[model samples]
Structures are given as structure tokens and as C-alpha cells.
Target: MRVLIWKDGENHLIFNMLPGSGPDYNSVVELSLGQALIAGGGFSSWTYRSGFDVSLPVYSPMAAQLDSQQIAVQDRPWVVISSQINIHPEYTQELAHLAQEHSELLVLEACPSMQSSNYSMRCRGDEVYHYPQVLKRAKFCLVIRGARLGQPSLMDAMAAGCIPVMCADSLVMPFEDVIDWKRAAIFILEENLNSLMEVLSSVSDEHVSEMQVQGSWLYQSYFSSINAVTQTTLEILNDRVFAQRARTFEDWNLPPNPLAARSPLFLQLTAPRSQGFTAVILTYDRVESLFLLIQKLAKVPSLNKILIVWNNQRKSPPHSSMIPKIDKPLKIIKTTANKLSNRFYPYEEIETEAILTIDDDILMLTADELEFGYEVWREFPDRIVGFPSRTHVWDNVTMHWKYESEWTNQISMVLTGAAFHHKYWSYLYTTAMPGNIKEWVDQHMNCEDIAMNFLVANVTQKAPIKVTPRKKFKCPECTNTEMLSADLNHMMERSQCIDRFSAIYGYMPLQTVEFRADPVLYKDTFPEKLKRFNDIGSL
Candidate 1:
């Protein structure tokens, strides 16, 4: 809707301007001009005329070009920008020189005549579309001031899954009330422009990865589309008007699942898993293997308590004469039913926050492996840390969740059959999980581990961590089927469980990660005395 006018020598043209400058208009789109209907924000501040809360700032969603291709988190050493000389000439010029020195720092030029450096380049005309792709590879996108107050690069960088480093003299971020941008973006004052490199360099790799994920999450949750933006604005207004029915800060920020809980870092950090872990072994008449497992577990230095869930109503409890005489205390609680779901029943005897939910037949795991896995779990208390890992893939032909037990680099689940998980999960599995999921596990007498994996990942929005190598949790001296995990029907049943569980939850929450935790000096050319977990079994 743009028209070009050719100037005549002595003629004057009359120009008439109207609000919105379109077919029909009812209100002005200016934030500063109106007393009543001025709700327009230039991509940042939402200044309500009759605002209910003065503390929370509302953001009018601004539309930006979106590139929907998702990429995994890669190795990044980036401090990037797309700068215009006309807007911030001094800043861009200084940044260009800085980029020449640090190969990691990149500066893209908006001015056509600007020359390309080893790390900096100019994007002209149609090349602007590729900006998001450039951002996708970067760890941080530098946001300098534009011609206006707020810049579009902030939104663009976030959409590209790049953390935005705000570098304006005075900057106010969008949706400051609801979205926690501080968790995602790094803010820098204009006076400390020279310290930008030092500040960015100080940020750890783990923190950078977290910020990138958070930035992308914030964008997708609030500003991906026009519909999302419009709806969010309306929701904000609704919340303001009806204060009694308003949601909490977590409700606005996090994905739906245990929104009230604090971050696991603060909550579980002080919980003394070091006082030792309580081993909860679920058994069904496998007395021989169960005793062997209990004997091995009794040797663990961190063994505090052992509770054997004797899930066999048809059979009588083994005589105390058959039980292994171990140093650690062992109590067998006979369950009312022989359900697989009995493994996760929260009992009063379990006193530790760290729970080793290992199967009775899993005797292949060494004491060193178990202790090392426990140490790893202490670091990531919210995740499932264990040996045997399983992955879920989408089958286009079948159009359902397909479970794969192959040895791949990536995995979505760490089977609780031999994993170390938080005791909090037992409570969640028994009560908080989706509709009739536990009952299904009971009826099938399988997939209780799968159900537990879902509940933990859903609560944390994080992937389960796989530790050391895998023996597929193979039990050499098992009287029963190998926990049904190695069987074809069991794999298929687990896959069906994933689909059914996803339907109940209304979304897939299991995150897939390409990683496995090994001890720091594991398998390296170090002295035998130096290596702690030397007995860690890996295939």
C-alpha cells in the first residue's frame, strides 16, 4: 500500500492523514497520545490507561519472521549482532573492530557500504530473511538500540533460540510482568560497553545452554503467532479485571505440571541423600535372585535402608532362614496384590529422598556403578539417572509412539528397573499421574517404569539422564521373564503405554538427550588408586 510521488518544480501537494491510515479505524495505535483507548505498544511496553496493577508491564505482541526448523544445542562460542551504522554508528564501528579481534564475536552490517570482517558481514535487502538462521547457531545475540526505543532483534533472537544480550542505554523488555526474561537474556548497560566481552565470557556453558532454551520457550509460549499474542493480551486483561480468578506467576510462566513447586535446585539441594539411599526392591517370588541383589546392595557404603515390596499374594513370604544376613536393615512388605504398579507404592519405611528403584533380579550392576550413579543423581536430583536407557520414536507408518531399545546415542527414558530416582516420584506415580495409567500398568503387569519416567519428565520438563554403559539390565539368574523388557511383546506394550500416557497427559513431556554420565576419570590412563568407580560395568 505504498505509492511513490514524483516532484514537480513549483507545485505543492496537499497530504491528508488519518488514524490507522486504512479503510476503517476506531482507535489510535499510539501509546503516548490517548487517554482511554491508547493500547498500542511499539513491541515493548503496554501502558494501560486504567490499569489494575502498576507493577506488571503488559507487552503488545509484535510479529516477526519465524523459521520453524528446530536444531539441537550445538557447541557455541558466540557474541553476535546485526547492526546498522545509521542507527548506532559508534556502537557498530567499535563492534566491527572488536569482531576483528575475537573470532567468536560476529557483527552483521545493515548499512550496504559496510565491509565484511573475518567475523562480521553485511546482509543486504533479501538477505535479511537469513538472519534467523544465523542466530540459530549463536549462543548470544547482541541487541543495540535502533532508530526507535525497543528493537525487533530481541524478539528475533529469542525466536531463533539464541539468548539476547540487551546492550542499550535504557532498555525495558516486553511482557516484563509475566515472562521471566532475566532467566533467558543478559542485560548490559550502555555505559559498560567495553565490558561486554568480559561479561559474556564469564557466563558458563551450562548457563548459556539454559538461557537459550529458556529464551526459545518464552517466545513459543507468548509471541510465536498473532493469535498467541492477541490471546495473551486478552488473558492479561481478564486476569487484571478478575483478580480473584487470576493465575500465579508460575501458571503464567511454566508449562502445565506442578507449577507451584520451587526449582529442584533450591528444594532438593538441602535434602540429605548423603545420609545414604533407601533401596526399594520390588519382587514377585524371585527369592534366590532377590537375596543375591540384597546381598550386593548391602555392601554399598551408602546403604541406609532396604524395603523389599513382596508383591505376591498367592505365595507365602519366605522364611527368615532363607534371607541373607546383611549389615543393612531389610524389611519385606507383602503387598495385597501382585501388580507391577506395587513397585512405586509410597510406603512409610522409605526415609531418604534418594530412592534406588532397582528390580530384584538386577544383579549385574556393581557397587561402584551404583554409588557413582547415586553421586550423579545428587547433581541432577530432578532427573532419572541409571544404566539401561530406552528411546521413543514417532512411527509415521503406524502413526503412534514407537519404543526402541537399541543402543543409540540419544534416549528419552532411563528404565527405573535399574535407575536411581527421587523418592518424590513414588508419590507422583501413585497419585499425580494421568487417568487410569497406573491401573493399566497393573492389569498388564508391565510399564510401571515407563509410567514413572513419564511422570518425572512431565514434572521437570527435562530428559532423564543415562549413566555409564548398558547391559540392557540383563539378569543372568532370573527365574521369571527378564522383567519383560527384553521380550518383543514387552517392547510393544511399552510403546503402547507411551501413546496411552501421552493421550492422558495431552502432550509428550519426555525429553530426549544425547548424553550419558560417566565418572570424571572413568576408563582413562590414570593410576588404579586415582580412579574411584573402576568397577563400573560398560559395554
Candidate 2:
């Protein structure tokens, strides 16, 4: 009858009786099956018959002249090996003598080998032999179970209190966790056989005692055949379930199996992009210019913000309703005539690289000319420059704006009545004068823009301001133009209003700055701000 018992679900694979006991009954019949199963992913299982008559095993301690408790030497030591190792008879005799000389132990297993006639069991002195009896008394068992058939002998040695010393290169026997290999086993690789004597000579008595305690622990824990069978079963079954679940989940979540699937695009256009310039149209009751400037600014690409500072006490602006769609921030500052400067001045608080200062009286710059002004500032960051009037149609050649330079020479202050790059207030704050020229403009004059040009040029080392052609339609305020033409007296009065500042600062020019490579390089250029617009195009 054949009996197959599985202990732990799928781990321990053991087989009991073979067929009829004939001449074909080989001692290694079940061993061959165990080997095949081990090679095919299964744990080892040995079988012993329940009712077979067994010889009584003897475990008597061998008689010796030396004390068993005390090691042969103090620090010097030795190892015990079974007689199964392949060594010549003459070499074995030599091994015995050397062990005695070094005070090392050579506790040999007293079994006669079934093969190989080269070595005999005969040895030197009082043969300090290791039989089954000696094994129970010994502290260590050096097991080298390399052959297919001799593992049972090694286990038998382990059952007797002798700690087995198998090489690390050998297959891990079952119940390995129970053995404290680090303490009890002295593992040597096959390649280091030539130096085995040196290893044996270095073993100590304390080391041997530690090994004995560890060996006893291993016997109680791992070497039990029943426990080994139970542990192996769980390992095989858990591995199979985990692999199956992993494959099933991965298949469910895998992306659309179509060969040409496209990935979603995640492009972001978050930042505010501009040609990076701003236009501010200044107004005082003249909503026409404000409307016209907004219309033209709307068409200018890359304008960041448009601001309309309307100096009208009686009215609020209809800017959002009147202007075309633009992708820049729009704001309006409206105030009475008396609070004109105060209300509009706060808009200057808007932080930017440059500011466009516009005059309500005249308009000449076109949409194209306004953008070109920004390009000029970006390119030539060192000096202030204004747009030039377009086609001589809006030209102000008849108007002469004269002022004196620092050296007292008369220079024209006239620029095309359009736009100018604004300067940072910090430049004025750090100045020896301690204020933007505008602060003093309302005090001593109405020409705040003109005074600022002089202050910037003076402090910045005579950098010339360049004027470009304006694209907006240039027109003068009717009230101011009529007054100037009607009376030389009124014209002189307005001119005298700015004369006090001129006397204090020197002959001020309308155009004191020249275009440097880039006005921004002057290090004090403010950002251009555009807050609001109107539908009227350029006025």
C-alpha cells in the first residue's frame, strides 16, 4: 500500500510504503521520489515505519585520561568531524597527531566507510575516537552532508546533543531557524579545504560551550520532522494566490488597449502676457481725448493695462460701455477740477516698469506709434523718448517751446504732443532735491511734465531725450489755444506761471532727454500702466 500525507496545505510532501517487498525493492526507492519532489518545488519529507524492530542505540561517553569538562588547552582549540569525510588513511593518521600537538580535538565519527579503500580507521596515540557514544558527550558535530544518501547520518548526530557544522554553500536543511548557526556552526566552503587545519587550530573552549547551548535550542525548535512539514505548505499556497490576484488587478486597470491612444495635453497659459507696455491717457474735462486715446490703445497688441485719469468734477466716465474689448486691466480716476492733481496722482502708485504721461490738450500718436514707443523704451533703456507726429498733418512745427539748458543755452522743449516714458518715484526720493519735480510743479508752476524732464536729465548726466513720430491725431484744447491766440498778455501769464521753477532750476528745455541704447538701463525706469480706454480712437 502507498500512503501520501500532506501536512501544511501544499508544503510537506511525504510518501510512506512502496509496493510488495521483492528483489526490486531498493533502499533508495522513496529517497529518489523525495529528491524529485524537492527539485520540483517542495519541502523534504522522511518516513520511518511505526512497527519495525529497531536496535537499541548506545550513547555512553568514551573513556579518556583527560578531563572531559576542561578543554585540552586554554585559548587554543579544536573541532570534531565525522569519519565520513574523504581523506587518505595515512593523512588521517597525520591529522590525529597534529591535533594533539596543537591541543586541538579531532573527534572522529567511528563508522567504517562503505566506499573508498584509500583511508583506514587506524590513527595515532590513544585514538581520541568519536562514536555514537562520543557524539552525545561532544560539544560540536561538523556535518558535511554533500552526498545524496548520507543526510540521515548528519541528522542522527544532531539528535544526540552534538551541534552540526555544515558549510554555508550546502542546501539549507529544514528547521534552519532553530539552529543558531552564528554561534554553534563553523561553516567552511569547499574551496578552503587546504586551510581547514588552521581553522581547526583556532577554535576555543568558550566557543565550544556556546555551540553546545545553541545546539540544544535548535533541537527543541526546528529539527522536529512534523513542524518542518507544516511550515512548507503555507509558503507554496500563499505565493500562488498573491501572483493570481496581482495579474487580475493589473489587467482591469490597464489603459485602453487600443494601440494608438493619445495622452491628455496639460498646457498652461496662466501668466499675463503683454508686448509688456502700458498707456495712460491724462484727461481734464476733455473726454474727447480720453475716448480717442482708449480706442487707439485697444488696438495696440501686448498692452498690459490702460488707465484714464479724468479731471471732471461734474461727470463719471462711461469707459467700459464706450471702449472695445481689451485683455488688460482698466481703471478710471475722476475728480473735480480743484482736486485734479490729487486724485490723479494716486494712480502713480501702480507699480510698473514705465508710465505714459499724456497731455489732454494735444493728441498725435496712432496705435502703431504708441506700440513703437514701448519698443523704443525696451531697446533704448537709458534715455527718455516720445513719439513723433504722423504725416506732417498733426505737426506742431509752428509751436516753439524754448528753455535754457544748465549752461544757459536756449534749447527747444517741444516734443510731439503724445507720450513719454515715466520715471520711478524712488529716483526722486533718493535725489538731493528729495522730491519728484511734480511735487513742486503745482507749487511754483503748472508745467509738472516739463520740470520732471529737466530733473531726470540733470541727475542722470545729460542723457538726451529722443522724440519719435506720433501715430495718434494731434489736436489742441480749444480754450487754451483761443486764449493764447487772442491775447499775448494771457499767453505770457501762463508762460510766467512756469517761469519761477525755471529761474530756480535753470533754463528748462521741453526735450531735455536723448534716447540712450535703452532708457531702462538708467535703473530708475517705472513700469508702464494702462488703466482705462474709450471707443473714439486717437484724439
Candidate 3:
């Protein structure tokens, strides 16, 4: 990427892109590069240049065009703003009469070419000055898209709270991603120049104000500082990588019969051709939170089956617990304290389109939230999965969890254990769980989920962590208590235990790995956090 700094002399900065990394990181790298350019005497001589005037910070051609006396004074109260500078002989008389009849804002027609008594004049094109300054002084800008599409002009106009009366089809528009255009700018078709007067007249101050707010919001959301482009770039440079992989449930010997006769579970629960996914929660003693999770998970629109793999708890059944038994088949798999059963049994039982491995202590999540996740997973299957962080509330906290959308370009390493693709679990099962139980069991420690993620990261050289958009969840048991006290203590303990165990034997087989130590928090304080807490008190 080449950046040209326009000062008294032109300074060029050439940036070389690294192999394997694409334009995704360009925005982030530019921040550092811009600082370097500034520090290298790039703007040293620019302080006292020819056209420098600090007081006249904002330069609006509209203001200049509207305040000059180059057009004929008009009788009507309305003002007609035009982009044309050349006052041709044919239209000069009409323009003068119109100005004489109403307020007219005309572009400067160079010397005595077309003089009028009733108008204000301003020059167009290059003499208008830079965008940031120009936009601040103008009520509205006549945007000729030839300047730059999706460039800083439109953004600046929006930022400065100026209304942009622009041509519909321009050289460049920031229509690259998604934007609600009606809420942003007033787009005029060149062919509809006759109606332009009417359009301008119809625009109310209130409408303009609303549009300004909407435009500003859009700009800040997608184009401002600390945006997705910036975040994604930072992730790449920081050695955090995210990738999405897709596979049919059939590929993993899971359910949702693409072939009709295969799954009894699907046949009983869903309509023919109805797509579904199962979430098999792996749990032990956290019964209260587990029941809460079941209630939340029940709200997910696409969930076909809910299976609770109760490690070494044959005495408990799904009906006896706080979790209700719905029309969908809910089962509790009881097993002895065999380490392998805790790790593998849930995966084995979740024979559906996709198997979401949730911890027992989650008590956050409604049907709509899960549906959002499913939709995101469908759209960006290559990017794995997404969910909002369940850590903190937005009102009390300063920053938000940035990853709660159907699509987000922002990348973070903090949400690995919360939500992920079912394919990832399968990958771990195949690659990391190939050996006998004794070989990998030592790999299991406190916070096995996080440890597994680290294991996957080491093996794959890609970050297994990400932020889920707005959906937040935490342990339900943590309510009315300091989050960092008992809740954080349990979490930290498990994490430290995992670290200690990994330090000892290095790697072990899946069967011997103990997943019981992984502490699942059960709160849904944040929208992204789906609180799935089992009724521990009842159990």
C-alpha cells in the first residue's frame, strides 16, 4: 500500500504486505505508519504555509456560494444552490431573474463572465479546500462522486453533522458493506435535476438532524477508530488468528438426516427436511446451573435435542431435575468415574446436524439468542462460530463485548470457551484424541476447555478464541456476589490447575483427561453471555 502525504512537497510512503496476510491488516498497519511519517519531519514545514489561517478552520463552499453577490436578486424566499460554475448565455438571464426572484447560491464563473446582483458565489472543484474543514461550515454539500467514493469527504460530511445532497451513482460510494442509505444522505439522481429544487424544499431541519445522527452512527460503527478493520489487523499482528471450517453433520456421523431414514431422533422430533442441531452439555455436580441452562437452551429455535451427559451420576434423571421434559427427546447419560466417559460420551451421543458442547453452569440464553448464533454459523461457516461474551454488563462496564453480531470483522482471543464451531470439537477428537486413554489423560486439568483451546492453538497455529456479539452469559451462582470473589476464584483455580498439570506430563490421551475440573460460570449478565445454570439447589 502506498500513502501520499500532500504538504509543500509530496512525500511518499510505500508499505510492503507480508505473505499470507491480505488487505485485512492494512488499516491497522496504517496507524503505525502514519505516526512514523509524522515523526519523520513530514509536517514540519506545513505549519506556516501560504493558505494557512487558523481562525478560518472550517471552509464551506456552500457558505461562500450562498453569501456572494454574483447572481441576480430574486423575489421568492427560497434559495437555489447549483453545482454549475459556467453561466452560459442561454441560462444567464433565467438564473439572474431566478436570483432576483428568490435566493440563489451559484458557483463563481471566473471574472466578468456572468455577473448577477442577487446571488452569493463560491468556486467549485479543487479551490474548495480539504474535506474536514469544508464540511464543518456547510449546511449541505453538493457531492459530485468524482471526488472520491466512500472516501473521507462523505465520512467527513457525516461526521461534521452536515447534510450531503449527493448524486446517486458516483465515482465511489461507501456501499462496499451494508448501510441503511435512507438514514444517511440525500441522494439525487442527475436525471432528476428538475426535481432537485422540490427535494431541497421538502427537506426539513428535523429530518436533516435525524440523518446526521444515523450517518454518524454508521460511520462510527464501521469506519471510525477502534473499528473492525483496525481490530482484525491488530489480531493478525498480535499472532491471534481466526479461521472458520464447515462440514455436514453426516460427515461427522452426526444426525439431522439429509438421508431420511438415518436418525430416529430427528425422525421423531422434526418435520421432514427440517434442519436441526443438538447441544450436548457435559456436566457433573453443577445441577442448579445445569437446569437453568436447559431452560435457556429450550428457547433456541433450531435445537432438536438436548442431551445431558451426567458423569458418574446414575441416580439423577432428566425429569427429577428442575429442567423440564419437553416434546423433544431429553436424555441423561449416567456413567462411572471413568475419565474417558466424561470427555467422549457427550460427543458420541450428539448424533445431530451439529453438536454444541456447553458446560452445565450456564443459565443465560433465550431462543432468539441461539437462533442468532445459528444464523451466523450458517452465513460465515468459514469463520467457525460466534457468540457474545458472558463476562460483564455493559452499563457498569466501560467497553462493550464487540462480537455479538451475525457478522463481525473484530477478532479477540477471550471468547474461545464460550462458543465455537462443532467442527472444532470433531477436529480435536480426531487429531488430539487418537491415542489410548493413558496417553492424553494427563492433558486434562482444571479448566480443560481452555487448556484444550491452547492445545488446539499450538497444533493448528491459529487462534481458537473469538468474541461473540452482544450475547453475554456468566455463572448464575455468581449473582449478588462480587464477580471476582468466589466466581473468579473458582475459575482461576481451574486455570492454574490446568497449567500445572500441563507442565508435568506435557500431553496425554483423551480417555484419561479429566474434564470435571472445568468450572462453568452460569450468569447471563451480558447479552452475549447465555446463562445456562442447572438447578443445583433442586439436584
Q: Which stretches of candidate 3 lie over 4 Å from their true place?
A: 1-274, 318-323, 338-346, 380-417, 430-445, 455-460, 464-472, 477-539
lDDT of 3 by residue, 166-259 (tens): 6535322332212346666787775564455567668776676566555555554433432433442333223312223222223322223343
TM per candidate comes to 0.55, 0.35, 0.34
RMSD (Å) of each candidate, 1 decimal: 17.1, 28.3, 21.8
Predicted model with the maximum lDDT? 1
Please give, for residues 141-164, the per-residue lDDT of candidate 1 as tens digits. Answer: 887765554555666677877788
TM-score of 2: 0.35
TM-score ranking from best candidate downward: 1, 2, 3
Candidate 2 residue-wise lDDT, 453-519, digit = tens: 4455554433334443223333654554532224556334435434544566665423323332222
Backbone clashes in each candidate structure, one number apiece?
0, 49, 82
lDDT value for model 3: 0.42
